[model samples]
Target: MVGLQSTEHAGDNCTPLSDERGSYTTAENGFKEKDATDTHEYDVYGDEDTAEIKYRTMVWWKAAALMLAETVSLGILSIPSAFSSLGMVAGCILVIGLGALATATGYVIGSFKLRYPHVHNMADAGEILAGPIGREVLGAAQVIFIVFLCGSHVLTGLIAFDTITEGASCSVVWAVVTAVVCFICTIPRTLNGISYMSVVSFISILAAIFITMITVGVNGHTGTVTASAHLTFAKGFLAVTDIIFAYAGHVAFFTFIAEMKKPEDFPKTLYTLQICDTTLYLIVGIVVYAFVGDTAVAPALGNTGQLVRKIAYGIALPTIIIAGVVNGHVCAKLVFVRIFRRNGMKSKHMNSHTFTGWATWIAICLAIWALAFVIAEVIPFFNDLLGVISAVFASWFTYGISGIFWLHLTPRSERWTTTKQKAKTIFWSLVVMMGALIMVAGLYASIVSIIDGYKSGGFPGPFSCVSRAL
Candidate 1:
């Protein structure tokens, strides 16, 4: 059996507990102790054995690749559909711009917290800046939002499955298959394998985009560049909200930063990821809009595969299907980890058992899919409502949190210290307040859309119109 030792060198401030004594010992008996200059050793796993905890830094490119994989998934497929429903020209510009601004703001806030590296995660940073209440609020909000986002991904996967396997099998069966595949791909013991999977997903998605562009180019199609008579500013902004909702994974990027070896590298990685994501979204949006046109884009490709298959038959469909599965897996694992930790379960330990852990994950995935299926069948306009809610939260998380962090972190004396800093503070604060007001308006608009959908006898046309108007 091997033993481990911890040496307390100069400047070490940790206090020794009563259980830590003068000699090396097995943990099953009690924790060992060490003096200022002596090394203390312990048995690994309460046995007379020792093991090393290995740590490695992530390369900049790996971080960028992970972020790229996450950004491209369902967001790319949803953007063009949103543009068609909301009005292409207006939706594309506003949504893409606002989403980028919000994301960049979040990166700034994260960078500010990283200046004091002792804080481990966003929740810890919130606590340092604002106290216990801030920690609880931020932690609870993050966990809940992650869960909802995971549920949203499950719903998206089911929708994709239904689209691909239309008329051949039941939607529920397809949903189960997709969920199981996602669970297997996720819930692993380590994050090392995800990089390769992410690369594959990225490649597959790019191929689909290539097919889409070729199809549009060969057809000599150039999409409508202006809004129609029916399109108004109100509809334009609402459509913008929808497009932002599809790209609202900015906050989630912080989770990766927390685990990164060099937290300071996050800003560069985040900026690069967002730039890549925006470029991809713009190119895909142009191609999809050109190929299908506004009149056909809205209702024709209800699923991602339908759109891909329409452009290219052999490879595009399967490529998109695999990409959807990868996205669903990543989202599920993220949500599960957050929820489990919030409930006081050690996710690392729980996730080690493949059978039990995966079974629990599968159950959660099914429940989310079931709820989505019911909403899709009964409400039909549920997607629009989801889009609005997601946008509201995304806006609050980006603008509100960024403003709060900046306000709280700056010293009171520095409030009026510099003209540029003062201007920045005011600008951020106003952005936060405006985001809050917009969220309120979005909620009201969502309610109105739902009512209109009910009155229209299950038709989502009125909701789409209202969504565009907002």
Candidate 2:
């Protein structure tokens, strides 16, 4: 509130602040002037008037917990399987290195944006760099990404529940139970409330990891764990990119940043979050590999070894189910919010206590859930294609956007004059190119796999075969 002054007269385009307490319009420069007495008590995110308390409460633990929770969703289980496809040594190394590079890039971009308090989200950055088209494209991509992500999560939860209870007569009952529980846990929470759930999820995932490590350690490092002889460097690299999908939730960091009371503190917290995520990923990959080895590591542990694998599978299955549900609900809300607002409904207007809003929310959830069920039943290979598509889009949104940002924001005077800035530009350029290449390759691979599956009743090449085997 200390720095809460109007920038409307500063020549920046802005919208009026809307709230029940007070309304303040902004000028073209995105600044607004308001009387102290008429100033709204709530934060920009529409949370309660506890700025001082909230700012103090966002310690390192909360930030890390949020990051960990978001990172560990359905991606975790899929990561090991992805790695197994590329062979142990190559897969492990690629996952760690790519994750580190991608995460570092996110941190740099996030930090740069945080330095300018005016910038709120990726859309804001896009607008500053490229204009109206940038904002629209980025916003649409983000909203669509969130919707697909949520839908995928819902599908994963439903499928896993069905898989786990395959022979049981009560499988249908369990599926309904899962959907209800996810809705209860996810709906009707403020952004901060979701963060708390994220913290709990983080803890639950870590516990699962601990269980895995302990089981592997107790079992000793002897099994069918040899690397595949057919794995080439190219295949390994692609596998690394595929596995990188596991760490593709950097966009969710924006949601966290929005909730932060002290936006300035976000950079350090974001870095900490990435560090913790990368560390956990490396540790988990190593532990799982050490436990099962290369040859034995399959898509689902049920296909590998029986007793120990089943134990690991049991621990992982529940964690995935919970994480998937949460991810779906969060994603569902994001898409729902965007669709509603685009249609002229405000966030406050979408209260569950209101019949219209509540019905809308329920309708959206049921639609997504039903779609997931249909996809699960009809297309057995949908998950593989979903993972690839998600990765390609995520890479484009992150790498392409960052590269464009650097290109536009860098001053003409310093284009080739300053070594540091020039180097930064070159680095981002390469990142953009690599990301584009990966996107193309992933799409090609996914399409080919689908076609091959249709023609031959089996996966096409090694990666597809490995994906199916896993």
Best by TM-score: 2
Clashes of 2: 14
Per-residue alpha-carbon lDDT of candidate 1 for residues 1-470, written as tens digits (9 for 90 to 100)? 01112233222222211122233322221112224333332211111112121112455566676667666665666666666755566556766776677665766666554433333344545665667776667656654554455445544545455554443555545445544555555543333455566676677667766765565566664445435326444554555565666556655555555445566777777777778787877777766665655643532233234456534322333433444433444445445544434211133323344465557677655554444334433445656567565656766665666666666555555555568767766776787786787677666666666676678786533112111100
What's the residue-level lDDT of 270 in candidate 2?
62
TM-score for predicted model 2 compared with the true structure: 0.74
lDDT score, candidate 1: 0.52
Off by over 4 Å in 1: 1-57, 85-92, 116-130, 222-224, 227-234, 290-293, 296-380, 459-470
Candidate 2 Cα RMSD after full superposition onto the native fold (Å): 7.5
Q: What is the C-alpha lDDT of each candidate?
A: 0.52, 0.54
TM-score to true structure, per model: 0.71, 0.74
lDDT string, candidate 2, 241-269, tens digits: 55666777666655556556665676677
Task: Give every collision pair in model 1.
Answer: 234-469, 235-468, 235-469, 238-470
Q: Whole-model lDDT for model 2 versus the true structure?
A: 0.54
